[model samples]
Target: MRSSRSWRLVVEAFPLLILCIGCGPASTASPTAKPATTASTAAAVASVEPDVPVAQPEPIAEPVDSPSAVIEPVAPQPVFRPDDPREPQDDAQLAELGIRVYESRRLKLYTDIDSDAARTLPGYVDQLYDALEAYFGPLPPDRNGTDFQMTGYLLKDERLFREAGLIPLDLPPINHGRHRANEFWMREQLYDYYRRHLLFHEVTHCFMTFVPDTQTPVWYLEGMAEHFGTHRIQADGRLSFGVMPTSPDEAAGWGRVTLIREAFADGHPRTLADVFALQPADFLMNDAYGWSWSACHFLATHPRYRERFEQLGRDGRGPRFIRRLTELFEPDGRDLATEWALYVVNLQYGYDCGRAAIDFQRGSTLTAETPARTVMIEPTRGWQSTQVLLEQGQEYTITATGEITLADEPKPWVSGPRGISIRYAEGHPLGQLLACLRAEEATAAETMLRILPIGEGRTFAAPITGTLYLRINDSWSELADNRGEFSVTITRAD
Candidate 1:
């Protein structure tokens, strides 16, 4: 997410409302098309300008009787240059053809939608620029020290843009959005938030073009776009970029979380390596986007890996980008894989990385002098280490005692080790005590941790030699609302 005051400058500039309509030559065509355009466009625009009547085109002036009386030739409007510097267009001409143009410090948006939907969008893009700069460092300025700016076509009618020569003939047909150099094109989306999301996603691609000679992997490229494109706009009009959506209501039509949960539930969860190996063709389906986003979000936000992950932005250019990234995590690769598995298993909206982080301390084996170990397992945390390593084929007895407050909203709902019966997570009772073995050599996400129910007491032979980790089973997204802890004791059994 962006800093607290990231939108201060934008808010000051566009207080109350920010839709700045451009002044241009009035349309010379019939007003019938404008009504149809509004009716067929996204609902956001219609809500903004519900009943505004379209203006009739200006009438052509009759030829003057005295042609030579005083006919000063009108100077043509200056060509607007996008960041690419390859093709420029006359801004006034585009506006005259029913396209409304919006400009900011970093973007020039041309669209045929009503002005209401365009409100505060330019400022929002400017805010996005600030966020991109915050994450990837400031982009290098041109020779004159001017910041880069891009051109975007947010199209409501593809035919209109094609007829106006705005869309290149050679440009490939896009279902949603595409970007090249400093220009991007996207069709109007069904929802307003999704429309902005696709816009930011493409704009992120344009921003990354500054990295010279970058042969960055396809996963990183698209993942980074997805990472930066997820955003939230507060009810007060404050804008925040790169945020995880807390609920479905807040981010309508953005279903990355749902896709991930469904994929994992179907037993096809993509491991970190699986995500890394994804090819460009894999992105033709939406599932690839979900997996890529999960991997990037995990590495970028997790405390242990975030520092090294952020270095990818600074040192991740050139053909050796993937090689360098692999080398960076190779040391902790096993632990990372285990943690990633845990993350995916519990993935949900508003996932808290700090609470889910596992403290990996190698455990000492049970001995004659040291027989048992007790660990405090917190309800607000994902997993806690017991510092006791069990041997393969050896039996161990586990006992936990304590009460915990699962929630305090309507009233404090307390539960013992047995947990509540009304709700369940991962097919287990909510707030039930759960156990898992984390072997040092286990690197595959699918088999790294096998959770077993251990409510109150249980005696079982070790499935494999590994450290013992325990937790109060609960929804990953709802961990923050929980309170209290459990006292769990482990001892070797005869």
Candidate 2:
């Protein structure tokens, strides 16, 4: 059964960003079925203001003066031509349009685009291949030792795209790309900014077919594709990601993020537990795709959950998705929904994953000095925790006091106590140490437990004479101005 991960606590002064975009399904279309809605190019472009960093892919080997500076083009190479006669008679009309066939070791391209666009096709496909391979592992070969080669049909315009008959004409123009089996089809953009973005997104669907049919949930199937689909190609062709927006001007994914934020504010945010229960066919809402992508982004790139997320994929079973979630998130008695709510509300482009993991330690020991010691919790300190020794039947008091100053919002006091008292496991020191060393590194769920709330602070007597691990947390106020300090002082009760 899906756990009711509730979110009733109100966070005062949670000022969120204002942006807008309509939600849609993935761009991939099944020829006979309704087109899967993808993030619309029009919607993506509309959401980005002149100041926001436009989401785009870096050209392979192009040098940059600055991140915002336009990428210089590489010297033109010849367009692709097939080594042998091209089969697939459906593309006959494209051949008449002076189409060129570019064949690389791993991909085959069919497009009417000129040499400039055609030359870059190989590099783009190669970049997507490397990125997808890194995350999902290498692709399996067919009966023939030759690697499975994916074919891309890049139509010159919507008219040509429609005439090609790859996607049904009934689908809306917003559907820019579609992946059918091992083939990918996409229409060319006039002023292409997210051209590579759309290309990678569709191709990712083709690559996903290799995963064992473990009845993979629709959210994961589409979410992971969109997650990698948003990957930024580096100058040297290596993939670079996990870049959270440092400034307002640098924000990307305004459309998807805006959609999710609005939903969350409306109290209809898609929860992980909810996503797990859904099948792919049923997850047809546009926000579902967007939330799925964000969820995948949170899990795949976030330092704390990366490994476990990969395991979930490798395990490739639907049940494992929920099982891992229960084990990793709810174990600490911290509701996943509450944590996710805070994450999406403040989410912007270029989120920093590594920094977040360090700031929010999952299973680490905190050093606490005796009697009256004050431990500071800062915005940069995500969820660092510590352990204090207490005698059975002895009472200890904990209080948190601080105020966070945002850019344009009121300075709210770092609300209520954010600490959890963990009962010490009874075991031999050597045995425990060995087990700790040998055991899978503990995740947040395995180590942390429910906070014993007593007033705005916790004043409780120890039930056993042992060390009590106190986890210091916040309301997930990850705003840039989340830069404040809360001091925790622990003392024995009279």
Candidate 3:
């Protein structure tokens, strides 16, 4: 059994999304193969045509002198004060400050100070709900209408926001927003971008109450809220999702993504297993919010992994769920760390999982009698795989040479075009990311053309005798020249 607790994402001034408490690899190339050449054989692809610039949500700075913006490493102090008396309800006094309550089919907005930004509160809430419903479906049945209808107090400025005493005075100022029970609070001035982001994030906290006895992991809970918090409304009134920017240079969370990726590069990356194993207390102790959100984004948008993630939602806590996780996500419960590292490093904003999906094919068969066999081939377009027959207990080495011309413009997944990889026949978490990368299961190519400095040269002993798949992939492909050109030589040792 797990304990219940609340979750939140706190930055200097950003509104933290808090949740109530309750609970809770690998190699390079093959052996016997020649050492991989790390030298650059090809120049990087020219820049691609720029895409229509998507506006990042404007950042709001909190007023100084307020200590609420500072967060310590200790356990999160309860910012939610439901037992505190409600704000004074004097119609005349409130009218003086332009306070008003707007009602909609699914929301009740309370604005402390009425203004153009305040008026649009309902519309934004509607957009958030529309996007959330489209992705997760209608709110869980157990949630009452009041649960969704938040009592939002839009303070006029940081001074007023701090004075309200909605949150602990010692905590950092939550510039974006804050939520307690069904009540939401934020400072509405300058613009609504930060305010909207806060509202969406806190509202998601409101929806969490509906989940049945299951004590959902804080990573998933906050990740899902961050997934929706960055929602963008289109001109047609449709809600677009998973729009977190690609680089920290692009937006706030985007920078966090880069930090996580860099941390991985530094050999300290947090794996999916680490995040999944977190209890309520552990989540607040570390700065995993950005990584958690990225994981959720990967699961939600990646068509290959989306359904599986949905299935995971139905699972409850305890050993049974752990068994399910091991059965579906981590077959051996070991390679998960290595496989997840490969997946997150290659992730990019608007990543198209369909393009880089794994495709196994019976490539030109190689006969391993004595002399080594070699062949020159190009990776198949997309992820439709090419394969080769291997025998159990036999050791093999694979070497790749040459590079493909990637597009000269910004593309999804990783930048430019991707290179190639080799893997054992297992499950595809998302089309491109492998479920398992056991030495016996699968391995990457020694070399491939790509931006990131992933390892080269794949060497491993065949765990089973059968047809293993070699996949041609990149972050994604768009232009005609997105394919990589390479030569692979396969050798068998006695």
Candidate 4:
């Protein structure tokens, strides 16, 4: 009877296991013919626009640093605490930083990530919780209204992290092929960082909680943080700020930025303020973080945009308000989607950051076995083709240029934008991801977007390009954010 049951199980699952494999005369995974073009032809209706500018004051730098400013943030005094080769940190001192943020921000710093998993680290955890209460007021982990939990996570190292469980960005040596653990940062590092920079980029996510927390594009969610997250304290009260794309995580945004900069890089650069008025929503075919960074950069630096951001910061996060905000400015750029598509094509042709002669093969799907140092194109606009046909073996990359939308559809299971569905490989683990993307002593109901679905869909162009990606996986079935859709373009850079 036991032998018979074993045979039956194998028979029940084989064919469904792998839809396709290895490229050949015609690998099972090969996309069915619809049309294969290096890039989809741009419809004239979505006219591309010119680059705008960030309107910052002539001496804006002086004011922020001055003592009389409203924020009056004290900068950190500089010191050189060289990294100890002997005490080599297995990973970036990220976990330590996580621990600190927990304590300082929430005042529940006792619960340490490295501490025993069975119970919470009271001191670390308490501080983290306390800080949350103070900043935007109370927020129970379970519910805040938004379907998704705008949260973050930390992990120790590659091996232990993968062993613990995570969705690998890619296979073999791909940066994303395997799972990279994102967990909590220890306490000291978190405060030290905040004191110097007078920044805790994480708090920006809190901004979402306060407002409708509407479907914020990836740019606003991460780009704003990247812009402000870099400040560090000098013991003497001077602040040192790192470029927004400081780390591998943040550096990834640059791939997209380079293209836009190049577009207006020559002759006269566009004003940052006018660029902000372009409204990312209007541009659906570019990398999200890059676009958002540029968008935020305009607000942070452009003289006019500086005033705009200051004004908006005073207002709530709502479509009506944002729409009203746009009315106050002039169009600096246009046709964001086309500009984005062209940028990816350029890199795919030859923008070696230090890898292959041409590492990225542009198309809906990528063919490299290596990991992407940067996400070349993260789509934000939703599908607007009026038709989308996807297959398991077929992969695609979406640059998050704006808020993308998706058609209504049921998926195998995944988190993020609604109407998204995709299947992940068998080895992928969903439980660990849920645990990792959280505050150290996170309550049971934290709405962190930890669930990785094989695929997700939304009208937003960036979020719903296709299921083929380097990292992230399923267990994300219910968390799909498929509320709206956006116009999208598919590419075949090869």
Best by lDDT: 1
Listed in order, each prediction's TM-score against the native is: 0.80, 0.57, 0.58, 0.29
Candidate ranking (lDDT, best to worst): 1, 2, 3, 4
The models' CA-based lDDT, in order, is 0.71, 0.49, 0.45, 0.29
Candidates' RMSD to native:
16.6, 17.4, 17.2, 27.2
**Per-residue lDDT for 324-440 in model 4, tens only?**
344433231222222223223222211222211112222233335421222322122211121222223334333222232222354322233222333332234321111111112
lDDT string for model 1 (187-291, tens) is 776667777877888788777765444346666777788887788887887678767777655565667776677777778887676787775545556666677
- Model 3 C-alpha lDDT per residue in residues 100-171, reported as the tens digit of each score: 666665566656665556666676677666766555545433212233455666666545434434344533
User: What lDDT score is found at residue 215 in candidate 4?
Assistant: 32
Which is superior by lDDT, 1 or 2?
A: 1
Descending-TM-score candidate ranking: 1, 3, 2, 4
Model 1 misplaced stretches (Cα beyond 4 Å): 1-83, 443-448
Q: RMSD to the native, candidate 1? A: 16.6
| lDDT by residue for model 2 (92-196), tens | 566675666787765788777877767776666776787677877765443345565678777776565456554444333443555555566676653232455
Off by over 4 Å in 4: 1-102, 107-152, 158-203, 235-287, 330-494
> Considering every candidate listed, which one attains the maximal TM-score?
1
Candidate 2 positional error at 138, Å: 2.5
